[model samples]
Target: MLPSPLAAAAPPLPPQSSDEDFFSTASTSTSSDSKPRSPPPTLPQIPIVWPEAGALTASWVADLMQAFEWASKALPPSEFPSVLPVAVFDKLVLTASKILHKEPNCVRIDENSELNSDCRVVVVGDVHGQLHDVLFLLRDAGFPADDRFFVFNGDYVDRGAWGLEVFLLLLAWKVLMPHRVFLLRGNHESKYCTSVYGFEKEVLVKYGDNGKHVYRKCLGCFEGLPLASIIAGQVYTAHGGLFRGTIITPSKRSKKKNRKVVHNPKVDSLILGSFEELAKARRSVLDPPWEGQNLIPGDILWSDPSMTPGLSPNIERGIGLLYGPDCTEEFLKKFNLKLIIRSHEGPDARDKRPDLGGMNVGYTIDHIVESGKLITLFSAPDYPQFQATEERYKNKGAYIVLEPPNFDTPMFHSFEAVTPRPKVNPYYDFEDVIDSDEELDLVSMVTDSGLQQPAV
Candidate 1:
């Protein structure tokens, strides 16, 4: 059963225009044959009606307004600048209980009030630009002004076609309700995925030569995102799991030298270096030639899922970290955490391994690891291709709802199954198949329902 938080002090906001409908007109402007038309005009300030007590502070509101204004002025008219609707902005205020002023480095939730002993936390998984799925999951999990806290894993972009829409929607939510939502940076939230996938292409198509501006804005936003979050100091969550050797320590090396260290657990050490230093080190670790069987802790930020158990046999291989159930349990014990929620895997895979440690430990898996971590949840679901039904797709989509632990209750929830679609094989070679009868037969068997064949 879903855990409901104590009565929220704030009231709910009115419904707003759906993001899909708002962007429908802009998305359909892809007529290559037509004359090159100018971009859309700058977006006007969405007059949001926020509750008086819950309204964002003047400075915070101003900073966001300035960003919107700058984004309007800097962005060209031909490109559709108004991605977020005004109504969505207004709804953000209705969901918060209280806001606080604290060190900008850490996200402090409910600092004004004592920690709500019965706080309910909803953790979501990777969105991968599946806006519709996200909405569905939110509806299923109870969203839009719910009193529960939320945390989104990462991988907000790339792979899916609607990456821009996903980014804009979440950014708008962040602006309107900074406390309710938190974003974490996934490995894909960097320059590499943006350049190769539909993310960069979408920006170019929407903004023309100014696409880089959008990309840079996204990267800048990602830079400020936290790598991980501790929920109630019991549930440790991040886009990726902890590195095997990531222990907290003090280092006296120069800032440059210290920046090269793989996993400095002390949060203060990260502040010693510039964004450039972090980016350079991140790039170096992500790229090849490092000598190790398992991935360097830094490299784990971008590593894909490896469900296999034990350290890899090849010592010099860069196949990424592979954590079995035991490793997860060990990490949780070391950190004094009951569970770990991560988002690097797809929904289907998540469904299969919802309870990573079998026994209750706090390792909850929210899919979107790239977004920030705090009191927010993601609604995005698996993209169209990932929605396939074959055995592999059976466990593809679903998020989790965690009720505060009780004497007889567990700390986390199990994975739920999502509707699956037909699986597509990426490695299948259609061109070479026509020459082989066996290949043709196999293809026919997969695509056709009634093909009589002799038994072996």
Candidate 2:
């Protein structure tokens, strides 16, 4: 059952758009039918394209740069991080929440919210709280709202030491460029995950134990973030991949029966009624009580796409359902979307075959499911947490600068791990606990179901 936080303050039902009529139809393929593409080349470790390139190209960048410097220096060469004054932290989080509140729970980016077809918008994946990589990413993208539009596909916190610095930088960008910059909810952002993964302790370290208040405030912001974003009316971007949950379908029995469908307007423009129960749920209050993994929220934040043909329960992850090509086709067709871009997994720089989604192409995990539509772009180069060592993190981090007119395929600019910090000490006894990351079943369903050549 989903958590009901708004028993007395129940939000009004969401509006249904006339365009939802497109959800049930098959969308035309925007994928390339061209020959196999060459793998993207590697980039410099510290690709400093910022201050040296002249002033940053955007307005909000200067402020973000200032905050970035403060955050970077705040951490002495020690393990413990400096604290943010409760008032200062409160102002920061509250400001971010206020901006996020303007977006729907299930946000629909209208034409005005999107850039032209031939615009280079940067798309990035999991940063797992690595602050330096984020700075590198900003330098690589030339900073948000500058010459390019940016979409951070989630996992902004957890696993690394500087999650606070990284997340605040993104929030600053969002507050500054509400339209030009977008942030999606990630698996790690949820309170349940943070308490387990590392973000909670990071907060406690940075702001003191009493700073659980800041943690709660962080949850408030996470709750407000959109689940997915549509770019240029063609791309469907989210932190995790597809979700197969309580399917809320409008009755086919009679058009009149579904005409007055009631959904939470605080949720989305699409009237998804009971589905709102799941979407609007206070996921921080799930099973396992105050700790441990729960089901519903787990899938949205944790699920992965399988190359298999049908549905399968992902017992390994213990929560999310593993989806296949048919599921991908249905989701894209349901939303009339051409591309499904997710970042829960990275690409494999070593693997040249795009169909074989693995840890080779920067662990990208791209599949030719229902055509060349779904691509995973992991952005934290030389990941600096858990057991993500220099060797394992070799798959250079990347951002897709997408444009149209001729924007049929995205161009990936990948950079090698930049002056990465050492891995965080394991919080658990590996001898006692089985490493979930090692046990992850991602890419287990690798096979060529008439694999199509990637446009990359």
lDDT value, residue 211 of candidate 2: 57
lDDT of 2: 0.55
lDDT of model 1 at position 385? 37
How do the predictions measure up, each by TM-score? 0.53, 0.68
Error of 1 at 96 (Å): 16
What is the lDDT for 237 in model 1? 52
Residues 1-456 of candidate 2 have per-residue lDDT tens digits of 112112222123233233321111211111222112111112211212223433222333443444344334434423232323456456656777887877754454445765664345778888877776676556545555433577888889876677876887687677666776788888767655566567777776666655587778888888777766777767777776765433334677775576433221111122211234445544443221111122345455666777675555544454455667777777776666678788776533223224445654343535555544787788766553555555653556667767765343677666555442433444323334333432432332111222222111
Candidate number achieving the greatest lDDT relative to the actual structure: 2
Q: Name the 10 consecutive residues with the lowest summed lDDT in model 2.
A: 36-45
Score residue 202 of candidate 2 by CA lDDT: 73
Best by TM-score: 2
Q: Output the TM-score of candidate 1.
A: 0.53
